[model samples]
Target: MATRRDPITWFDALNVVLLTMVAAACVIPMIHVTALSFSSEGAILSGRVSLLPVGFQLQGYRTVLESAAMMRALGFTVYLTILGTSVNVMITALGAYPLAKPDLVGRRLIWLLILFTMFFSGGLIPIFMVVRALGLLDTVWALILPGMIATFNLILMKTYFSGIPTSLAESARMDGASEIGILMRIILPLSTPIIATLTLFYGVGHWNQFFLALIYIQDPDKYTLQLRLQQLITDGIGYGPTVVFGQADDIPVESVKAGAIMFATAPVLIAFPFLQRHFVKGALIGSLKE
Candidate 1:
């Protein structure tokens, strides 16, 4: 049923080779980082490590877990990701659902406001002031609240909603279903793909957050993993003078830093394959818009 294409096209051949090179270029550094994380500093510095560790060890992970501050930060990051992502999904769904309906009163004006905010804003100071006024500053809510719902994500969701056959929703309404009922029964089941994709996006953003945490959280105990990891790397030799830092039984310092990076990324990477099915569907979420 499919027509065979000529294999002699010059650009097509070159494109394949170019894409393979790009894949290698991207994958190699990640491989190097993984290899180095499991290797000893001496082995790494001596150029003994490559795609694989010269001296295999689990000391990096051990050291990372042993630190009180690092452990605390890890816990906080996990808590934030779970809680923040839930809020993002719920709020975005609520906001996007009404906007997606063509018959909703003042839909255009509401959409215009959302779009305006996407392109222009009151800037950092005003947002910070509002956060501070709400007394969310220095609290866990600060990070979550500031970026709870993104306009761009809402637009993608709205577009997805628009694509769903209106008759499906109308049929529900004709069957004595309320707006809320229609949304729950008709819309949500069909919206799983886009939801999963946006969940991944929002979850990753929360996991990798740094700026707000750095600015709002002054307490050392409340720091997120990213902030704590940053301190670990920057405070490398300098958090010294009085403290030799790493306890004698603990793993080497650099190894721990490497391990932290590895661990933080592990959850996000592992989550992807599980949501891989939804991701393919998500590619088409906004495609039908406009």
Candidate 2:
């Protein structure tokens, strides 16, 4: 006999409709922006573009790509994201591994101290002073060192590590495996889900880094993508040799803005697909207790 399925409830139907609407709400704007970026000047000015590009052209992208300053910022942001995310994941994993052990001295106190940072922190001026005092100003370290270990990600990692069976670690210990060896061989190997999740989180954070770069970096050459994008949108700054004199007038300002936004956002969107399989599973598992 075939198994009978239960009929869908009204509540389930309502939830599906609501979630679909919410997803559409989030996606439609991106579609519009993309369309705007690709649409021709005439179509953009006439407001003829919506979900799809009308009279499609690559002028906006060509203008963005041609700019030296924008290219530098893109390169810098890419480097920062890769380096910063590596540091974040490694540091968080190392820190979480120790805290996951039940016998660690002052574990509770140490956790409390770390937890305190979540609720409170030295304000912006204090943080700026600390950064300055450390002589990290105008350097990439200014951006990386201060926010290396995100508190929430650390907590997630620690929780996930705790859920790993102690029997594995015990067996390793019996085999004369050092704590570091155990972590490297056993704990880390099993913690892929959380690691991947935290990697995505930290990667996104570093990719979007802007305010810190603005505050700490005085040199325009060191400016990040978001910062440069801001200048493009607000100051109406012309980019590249092509934009000089009357050439910039040929490119519509709105299209350039849309294009710039899409360019800055594209990397993260491209990266998400690779990590999405691990992301939800990691987040849910890490958040729950065994």
Candidate 3:
């Protein structure tokens, strides 16, 4: 029998207060950044901006959006996100499905190898040499293929796939369905939670990618959004000049940096909820297997 527990106590009230403070600690900085991004150079220079936007000018956003290089980078970033996510889904699913099955031939050897790779890896020089050998340098495929199958995501997927009923797979086999058919028609349809989670993970990774693009993309036209934002923060820093209303004045560096951060983060923030919904269902998939 279950033991009776006391109702919410004074500690619970303290817990709520602590959680609220933690939330504010995270959120307040973001609010400050947004406010900084919207404020004038003078106000920012004087350190007057706070939780609310000051000076109320759209100049910083205009500076960010008006660049052709930034526009091109934005386009490439979006393309990379979509293309990378597609590849990630395909590779992760293919890799996970076989690993999830205990009866598959050489399963233990394959798993041992995969785990080995997780614990150790060829360093960056070796990888760069291989990419050079393949002539993948300065190409989009360079970014996509190198880090496509993240070991941890693959492990999560395999664990979730293992939770599907053995009887279901057996019934499909008895019906003369091949492994591919069984996977497509049975496993995927029922694995929405895992799929959703993977999509979000891969999508966010691609969207905010900077380091990969820095290494693999030589052309300014193909730079990712985050890279362009990074350049703006680095190159656009200057003190304010007293220019006339019709002319551009030097905007505050903090505002541009804040704007860049917001631009980089907004998409993931928008995408998080849809992805987070999948976690609980998939994370515990193996527990209820028939």
Candidate 4:
């Protein structure tokens, strides 16, 4: 027997139309930027480029790639992302696991204290002073250590861990498994979805890290990719003076900026696909309470 389906209403149609417009608003600019990046200087300057390149060329990318400063910034950003995300996930998980245990003494008080930090903080100057006092200024640790365990990510992880059946942990404990052993061998393996979700969250944060780097890192050589892109866009600094001087005709300032934007954005776009399958499920599950 065929079941009768509800007929589409005006609200449903309106929602579809609005969502499509929103999606296009987000996507069209990216397409235009990509087109600008690939199009010839003449095409871009004449406004001939839109969603598609008018005269395809790779000179902009070539200029960006040939620069030593941009390459160093890219390497440093990659290193920061990897190291920061690893520490973030590990520390968040370890903290969440213990809090998830119902038998843990003072769990509620500990949770309340942690939760208090979300609404209140020591402000920028105090944090900067503490970092400076600790001799973390002008060092990578200044960026990583200050904002290590995000309160929101920790809460979400704890909620996810709480949703897991207690029987699993009990079974591991009966076999004389330690807390660390249970977390590593049983809980973490089963929490892959949330782990992957948080990994993406923390990874993107680290990748797009700019203000922190700007504040802590005074050395131009240690600039992150975003900072380098900012320099390119604002100062018309095309990689270096030599590249700019030689390729000025082939790669215009606007084209270089577009290419640099794409370069900074590409890694996150590439990595998101691998984690997309788990992202929605993990986010939804973690946000739910038992």
Best by lDDT: 2
Q: What is the C-alpha RMSD of each candidate to the true structure, in Å?
A: 3.0, 3.6, 4.3, 3.2
Tens-place lDDT per residue, model 1, 142-231, is: 999989898778888888887789999888888899988888888989988888988988888889988999888887667898887676
Q: Across residues 68-101, which tens digit of lDDT does each residue of candidate 4 receive?
A: 7889889998899999999999999999999999
Please, what is the TM-score per model? 0.89, 0.89, 0.88, 0.91
Off by over 4 Å in 1: 1-3, 9-11, 235-251
Order the numbered candidates by lDDT, best leading. Answer: 2, 4, 1, 3
**Residue range 173-253, candidate 2, lDDT tens digits:** 999999889999999999888988998998888889889998999887788998887777765445532322125656676
Clash count, one per candidate: 0, 0, 0, 0
Residue 76 displacement (Å), model 3: 0.5
| Model 4: residues with Cα > 4 Å off, grouped in runs | 1-5, 9-14, 235-251
Q: Candidate 3 regions off by >4 Å?
A: 1-4, 7-10, 234-253, 280-290
| lDDT scores in order | 0.80, 0.86, 0.79, 0.85
Which should have the higher lDDT, number 2 or number 3? 2
Model 3 lDDT tens row, 1-290: 22358677798789889999999999898899889889887888898999998898877777667656656778888999999999998899999998888889999999899889988989888998988899988888888999889887888888888878989989999999999999999999988888987787788889889888888888777888887776655544431211111133554456666776787778777877766768666555534442
Best model per TM-score = 4
